[model samples]
Target: MKRENLLVLLAGICTGLAALALTMLGNPANMGFCIACFERDIAGAVGLHSAAKVQYVRPEIIGLVLGSAVTALIAGEWKARSGSSPALRFVLGAFAMIGALAFLGCPLRMVIRLGGGDLNAVVGLIGFALGIFIGTRFVRRGFTLQRSYPARRTDGAVLPIIMLGLLVLFVAAPAIFRLSTEGPGSKHAPFFLALAIALVIGALAQRSRLCMVGGLRDTMMFGDAHLLWGFAAIFVTVLVGNLILHKFSLGFGAQPVAHSSHLWNLLGMTLCGWACVLLGGCPLRQLILAGEGNGDCAVTVLGMIVGAALAHNFALAGNPDSVNEAGELVVGGISMAGKIAVLLGLAVVLAVSVFNSRLGAKKNG
Candidate 1:
């Protein structure tokens, strides 16, 4: 294998292994490392949202930001930058999380879910690809977010430092810090072990710039499957690891913490996929970029946290038995989460059309 390919493969393996370790250590089923879910949990932990069921300080997420920061700084890639449609990126980030919660996973978790034999993730992946395909159409039509310029040093350091503070909180395990007594937030691996695994994965992801969105987008826009291969490795590694650990359960129904609503899964991930493409990376990529001093991505990350909070507060987030009960508004046996995805997808596409018109008017003027 080529050296670069080897690096990417190693990164994927690292992530897959970390996910397995987390699951074995007591993280929720098929939820070893989910950007959207973890952020929602963090939102709950910080009292941003009052969903008592999913509140915890996810150390892996904090580790991801800090590890990326450490790697970026060591590699001298930590130049602070911002101002590339920050507002729009923030909105897209929010929408991305909205859809992800509806589907109950991000792209990475989607892959891991598939590896664990959740056929529901298959539909989600299809929706993800469809969304990416549509977004690529916008790209072909000259959709642009302009450019990011240099910014202050503090702009880049803020999130990393905040993450470090979170790490301290995790260690302190203070009673006043609002942690989940039950649900996914309560399920976690050994604190230090999970943190160490997360740090390794985050460092590797930062170094390799691992992103499932970019991989799929590149494969679609070009014939390059190079990036896609790394993700494929992740899927296979996770699958094999799950099998060896007796964690692999094959079926569409009876999946842990998942709904059987296929259409909604497709729709939710569609929103996430389109927003990811528009923002130029997945949520994981945004975290890595934020770690590397991208203030715009940091703002985007902030948007995701807010989005998670809103999802929980509004009951927009889905769970295993919530398809017909207790989440968002259920209409005639259907949850409003799917409707939200459709509306969000439409709204974002409409925004793109408006941008296109403005650009055209400028050209004519």
Candidate 2:
């Protein structure tokens, strides 16, 4: 195997193991790492919303950014760049978050849920692939967000510095942050331990350029499975680990942090997949890129944070399935507001894709 492919596979293995270990240590089931969920928690912690149950700054996020920054610097890969449709990217980022929250997990978490045998995630995967397929059509028609330019090092450093400050706030002044007394926010592995594991994974991801969206995107657009290998490795590793640990349960209902609304699961991830394609990366990729001094990605990350705040404030996030008073399953799903948001997001993304395409440009010209 090529060295780069091998590195990505290794990164996948490490990520799988890290997720399992974090769950065993204290993180939520099948939620050892979720960029969207963690960011939502961070937003709540910072008082961006009034979600009392999901408020707390996650250390994994802090570690992921810092780890990528340090790794990029060491590898001489860090460079400050920005200016490719910043405003549009921000809107894309927001919609992307909304979709992920509507589905209740990012692509990475979707894979993790699959590993844990959640049939609901299978529906999500189908939706995500369909979205990617749609996005690829736009790409084939010459969709372009235009070019970015180099900037001062300080511009790139801003995100890393902010991540550092968040770390400080998490560690030095925990009292000031609105920590969750219950729910996903309250569940976590040890702070330093989660940070340390995430740092290692971040370094590996940075070196390997691992991304879930890139995996499928490359396969459809270029017929390359190079990036997909990493996710494959992650799935195999997690599947094996879950089985051995007896954490694997195959079913459509009663999964942790997930709802059984198949239609929304499909549509929500479709929105996420399409938005990430236009943004040129997934949420995880955005964070890694931000760490590598991409100012545009940093803005996208901030937009995601804000989107998380909006999700809870507007009651647009999905709810997990629950057992009701009669001891029967109550299928949880997003509200009508969430449904409208996803549809609107799809319309907006479609518009962006069309206007940014060569065909659209020719018509305008």
Q: Candidate 2 — which residues are off by over 4 angstroms?
A: 359-365
lDDT of 1 by residue, 25-141 (tens): 899999999999999989998999998889988888888998899999999899899988888888888889988888888999999998898888899999999888888777766
lDDT of 2 at 28: 94
lDDT of 2 by residue, 1-365 (tens): 99989999999999999999999989999999899999999999999998998998898888889999999999999999998889999999999999999999999999899999999999999999999999989987878777789999998888899999999877888999999999999999999999999999889999999999999999999999899998898888889999999999999998999999999999999999999998898898999999999999999999999989999999999999999999899999999999999999999999999889965467546
Cα error of candidate 2 at position 87, Å: 0.8
Minimum summed lDDT over a 10-residue window in model 1 is located at 325-334
For each candidate, how many residue pairs have backbone atoms clashing (under 3 Å)?
1, 0
Residue pairs clashing, model 2:
none
By TM-score, the best candidate is: 2
TM values, all candidates: 0.93, 0.98
- C-alpha lDDT score of every prediction, in listed order: 0.83, 0.93
Clashing pairs for model 1 are 315-328
